[model samples]
Target chain A: MSKQGSASALMAEQSPGPLVAFENVSKIYGKGDAEVRALNGVNLQINAGEFVAVMGPSGSGKSTAMNILGCLDKPTSGRYLFKGVDVGGLASDQLAMLRRHFLGFVFQGFNLLARTTALENLELPLIYQRIEKARRRAMALEALETVGLADRADHTPAELSGGQQQRVAIARAIVTKPSLLLADEPTGNLDSARSHEIMQLLTRLNRERGLTVVLVTHEDDIAAYAGRRLDFRDGRIVRETRNTGKPSHAQ
Target chain B: MLSNTLLMALREIQRNVLRSGLTVLGIIIGVAAVIVIVTLGAGTTRQVGSEISKMGSNMITLVPGGDMRMGGASGAAPPFLAADVEALRRELVGVSAIAPYAQRMDQVIVGNENRRVNIVGTVAEISVVRNWKVTDGRLFTLSEERSGKAVCIIGATIRKEMMAGMEPLGATVRVGKLSCEVIGVLEPKGQAMFGGDQDATVVLPIRTYQRRIVGNDRIAQILISGADSADLSDLKLQITQVMRERRNIAAGERSNFSVIDMTEVAGVMQTTIGVMTTFLSAIAGVSLLVGGIGIMNIMLVSVTERTREIGIRLAIGATEREVMLQFLVEAAMLSAGGGLLGITLGLIGAASIAPAINVPFVFQTSTVVQAFLFSAAVGVIFGFMPARRAARLNPIEALRHE
Candidate 1:
């Protein structure tokens, strides 16, 4: 039994499949007259260690696709597979387990708990993961150091600047050592200089850590940083671009 | 997970001190009210029971014409005669002693000191039946009592008021128009439960009192003392039957007189107080429900205000159960904390007010624990809807809520 378990564990570690897949997925918001087709049978695949950006206008359903990819919402009539396991049939708790083990999220507003220190905010995910206090503290500090905000671990969000808060939010996202980092307009609230700093951090993290990233942004310069890009329009991916050379907007 | 949730709940409550305090006010008042009312009720019942038992152990009083509890209005119904008392003594078994007494209010002059006091006229057996002792001098001799001598027994209050520093025994005091010698000073009996001075009266021979005071041989009350092994109710029944025969009352008609057992009176008073305590506590419990509603209201507002926070948590992989547990824990902590505070306040309130109301401060550990658990349950019951609302929020919409 132990030998079989070890064999399966090794196979799971080197699984030969796409990390995420959307097979003709669709999401409908309402019924009949008020129906809104948020995703229209879109198909996509993302492998390990890839930095991808999704770009679209306000009503083009890019956010809906991100929500589905993040497992925050289920597809209406199609399958979403994560690590070769179908997610549409999973219960809510199982979906939560998937999110906890594999996904990390960073929002546009830098959603750190207010009035809480940066270290505590970073420990939030680890707490949910049921990690012990000593290890959780150490991991949170390590994540803060990775985001270059270890000195500000004791400072509350209200005491930090917008870029610093975003850094804390990024540290919280990576604190659990998740497989995929999901960032939606992570630099939307920052100035140009702060935005450049955040982008540089994301790019370095993607390259150095080989962390898979799925970022959704509307700005052309923001999307330019990713190695691959997809443009959405009218609930469908209209175009895909690959950058084999250096990023066009690199410093 | 539960501890982490509880810690988070504590942090959230601490973050909004004023709001949390206001939310728990109803629970505080409700719990405090329940504790105070019930404690005082128990104290009062205990006080009444002890005081009544102190009057005489295993004693019963038969009043002519009416029930003692109903003011004993001896207006038209005939007074009990001496023959009725004699018959009870002779026929009733297990009766240790019996004393028939007639009382009248009259001025008793002791030189410069004079006071209007209740003058009790009864047999020498009254000292035995009432368990009264002569602290000084001696009780009337059998010959003195049989010949109707004008010898009196002054109670402790009379001794303190009329005699003061002087020795009261062997002193002569004028009772109404008649002169009486003070034969003894009765032992002090403090205040009665129903609010009369038990030691303020003077006692005299019944024959002398009948001849000089009222000019009649009528007896107003008969006090009976039963043996330690006697069944008081059975003795009371036998006495009632004998009295019915003596008065020639038919079996179907209600007797004009009443027999009161002290223990039964104590039981009735305690039961009545227990019922009142339950009733008042129920009213106070209603306030606890209102407090629970307050917690629900605040929790709902918190959920709405923290919509984006909930979204962030959901996105970061908190389960719906965890989210609900967070809110429920917050509410339970608030109510339980309030209950604790109320217990302390109620106990203090009861203790301070007990002396003023002449009752002992009484409380039980079970009462405190039950109150605490009950308040916690109130939080969970009332907090379910709000916690469910928080847990069921769509992450997308919650994230977008302003």
Candidate 2:
């Protein structure tokens, strides 16, 4: 077993192309008489600057896969590599560094802190980076401008509309200029028109800024926007498809 | 990092203004009570020390009982006599001056104006032993004491009452209908350490008092002075033995009279006031403990209320230490602010009452600093558990929380 592990370690040291790669990863909750495996031997690879979508039913473990990919949770047993580094063996602090340097997460709930202004919300990520006040403010403002929400920078979450609040969350996520942008049901809480607007903003960021995007959603209409789509069933990716259909130019 | 924590703490406090204010009220009361009690106690001690010092450190008083009763009362034993004074002076190695005094409260009349005052009849040596400074004229002469003449020295209060518009020196004041010529006016002594008006006194010769005032030759109290070069313990022993022999007391039996050193009395007063202040401060310190608990409770609530915020900070890359420090800083600010206010109010309270009660006001820098530091400590200690709880929360769970 030790010889095999060393041989595989040598193989891992030899190949380093994907930004994030998962090989036969599985996560199970409970054991024996009552067991629930959330992920089952999933294999996937996400390259830099690629926009991918994960589509599945409620119990298909898409969220679990997203959590593992975002470095928020560890897989039960598997080999996961983030930027050529073995993620499963990394410490909590190392995982935090990965999250800070490589990944930015935008949740569906428009998770802007209550009673905090839009500018302060955007500055939250840089605060963790220990950036100085002047630099943090400037970066937050630039992110706000990128999201076309600079005019509402001083308004609080309560004062902004659903779309505007989501924009602030996006600004907060992107302010650190992370390599990967993870959006979990990014347009789940918005109306159809607002959802399209938010999706367009994400697409623009991914195309223009060369930021890798991983979007999780159950809706087919939302899944069609991604350049590539992966379908999951019973905790395993059952299908992969490229979006070769005609593009809708409705702004 | 510390400044960031402090800013976050300030913002959190500002966000929940009423909740934070209510939580810190306990500390405010606790710190305030401690300051007021300690300040007043120190002021009282200072006032007592200065009053005793003014009466001359070398003076020793002979009370009627051997620490038995609280106040002076007529006992079965005869009063202290002039022979006991003479024996003490002769046998004691550190002999200075001795003055035998007797007192009675009676109305003194100067024409139509009459006022009640303590009439003290003492020997000629009282002037030197008691350090009684004369404002005008002079104390009773030795000749007047020897001849039992009706001559008296009046205090500031008596002079004000009897000689309101007239010159008190060489004026005549009647004590219980017997006219005695005032030979001197004593300077203002303010108040006595034991709660009596020291300025409301009229002094006359012991012989004159026995013959004309109370019609008794017995002395109520004796005042002795120790020589500047003599050891206090040796003088006390010698005086004790001499007084015992003069009173004819046998071996093994406790003496009827007690000789108390003024310095010893001052020491006892200092200890009593010190203990009282500590006890009051302890009671006040309970409020600080309650204040600490309040801080803990509010911090706990704050953690629960800001769980999502904590998760966001964690996701953004804040370490657990940073989260813990933020909450701790908030607690410290509340407690320190309360402590500062308490010290100010306490000083004000002490200063306001010191003059009314005739105690010299004093401010102790050490006590003020101690109270402030203690208040801050309360915040840190009580604030720790809540901060730890906030830091240890699961980021995933907290993010999912509504």
Candidate 3:
């Protein structure tokens, strides 16, 4: 409706200490006889520094919800706000700028450029930010160190193993120091042992830097690593659980 | 940001080295063809102009035929007579000097060395009209022209070949059956534009030729020079009309003689060669268009091949404009690189071939720059489709593409 989001909306969002809030958001796909609702009037809020795991079976709108949170997709209807600023009406370029300054993404597959070295892959996002080369290299190296892959910076993704490649992808994601790291099934392609290693790394990032983490995973064990969980079923959040599982090593 | 995009484009081109080379090949051949054809055409055109001017300008030749360009008589249409030459001198408005001309092939013998030479018979006016400079001795005077003396002027080819170490002037060389003294040695003139030795000829008084050699008063050609201030084309038309009147041809009837203006001939030849050159250049441009299509094809393939890479760049916060610019730069580089190669090839080919045919290698700088610009244009025009395709791709769907 182009109205300024009411101050009550701010208070309501802040009640959950929200860094990200989705209000009655919906996403529909296809048209007419083939129409399918991906998400329907979903309302949710995740506060600052919260590592929230989104768990749902396929077609349950968990991916769609995560997509909207990352500013990668727009809702068909309703207001989605990031830090109390409406993002639903922002242009595509504005969304890109938002992602450049405030967001990072990690994918299920390590999507680092195939021909580039791991260090160059990590420097990719910084290139878009127009950061100077020397400083971008330093930032990339620091991100690699945080992921414990500093020694593997020169190796290509094809040259590295799956776990090492995923680490490189994570390094690339956080190289720009984004406040909210959106991870879509980050451990989906890894074995359990490597999955736990990646989960530990994500938990460390969330705990130490207070980086807001929104992770999508179908695995319950992967969900357990988060401080909170929002479970989806048939385009709606069916349950919210404040985790009582092992404390993700309780930073 | 621009530098980043340029580097990215370069990296992509380097990654697909074979495809890039194949893509640029069309531009190379296209641009090279255009340059080489146009450069050589220009050189030939210059050569033609210089050749025509060498023969003489502001001079008109009256041939005894309806067509002036045909070298030979058109089926015996009555060769020009001395009376017609006199009438031309008296009736034509801008006539400055006129010569009655006849020519034949003769066997000349001197000191047991025999050579066949072209013998031209004309008046003393030839000296003034044709710019015939005598290097050794003086041209025959008007008295000697009327006296029917067996005096001749020899060109450089015969002076060097037959006389060799002897002084050619004042030496008598037997022509046909009569002995004639070489009174003057003409200056050396190089080969003609259409390919003949211009210096291997002889000139003698027309009266002597008519009385002794051909045994007739019939003139085969009449050469006239217009006054310094006269327009040669207007003079030519006036001569044509006067000749028609003198020949007693009826109105609307075709005149039997043709007045050939050298300047007009030069202009027509220039225009014809210019059109031919442009036509050939246009044919060569087709290949450049094909080269552009080649760029488009390779760019499209490149876009599809790098779909995931594009998605990754977009997801990492690259604007669509940046992505499009990257691909555009790549295309421009390919075509521009090909353009440079083509120019090099064209110049090299011209430089090597020009001397073999004895024409100057004329490199038109504007042509080179134009070809380069055209190739760059091809890149931009052809590269846009693929670039737009890449730019318009949805980030999510592109990332999801396998």
RMSD of each: 3.2, 4.2, 4.1
| Candidate 3 wrongly placed segments (more than 4 Å) | A1-17, A148-155, A244-251, B86-96, B108-115, B135-138, B159-167, B170-174, B250-252, B355-359
Clash count of each predicted structure: 0, 0, 1
Sort candidate 1 into its docking category.
medium
Interface Cα RMSD in Å, per prediction:
0.8, 1.5, 0.9
Candidate 2 deviant stretches above 4 angstroms:
A1-16, A244-251, B68-74
Of the two candidates 1 and 3, the one with more favorable lDDT, higher being better, is 1
- Please name the candidate that would achieve the greatest TM-score relative to the true structure: 2
lDDT of 2 by residue, B13-118 (tens): 8887888778888987888788878888888888778877787768777767666332253576568776776777677777577888788898888888888889
Residues B1-402 of candidate 3: C-alpha lDDT, one tens digit per residue: 788878887888888888888899989998888888888888888887777666666888888888766344556688877788778778888767898878888888888889888888898788667777889988888887888899999999998988899999889988888789999998987877767777888888988888888898888888888889998878988888888887789999988888888777877887898898899989989999999999999899889988999888888888788889888999998898899999999889888888777677898999999999999989999999999999988888888889
The candidate that achieves the highest lDDT relative to the unseen native structure? 1
TM-score of each: 0.92, 0.93, 0.89
On the 0 to 100 scale, the lDDT of residue B83 in model 3 is 83
lDDT by residue (A1-251, candidate 3, tens digit) is: 11123322433444334687989999999999998899999999888888999998999999889888877899999889888778998888777777776788899987889979999998889998878999999999999999998999899899999999998998888888777899999998999889999999999999899988999998888888998999999999999999866765433
Give the Å shift of residue A67 in candidate 1: 0.4
The per-residue C-alpha lDDT of model 1 at residue B72 equals 47
lDDT string, candidate 1, A1-251, tens digits: 34334323433675688989999999999999999999999999999899999999998999999998888899998899887778898778777776776888988999888899999998888888888999999999999999999999899999999999999999898888788899999989999889888988999989999989999997888888899999999999999999788876677
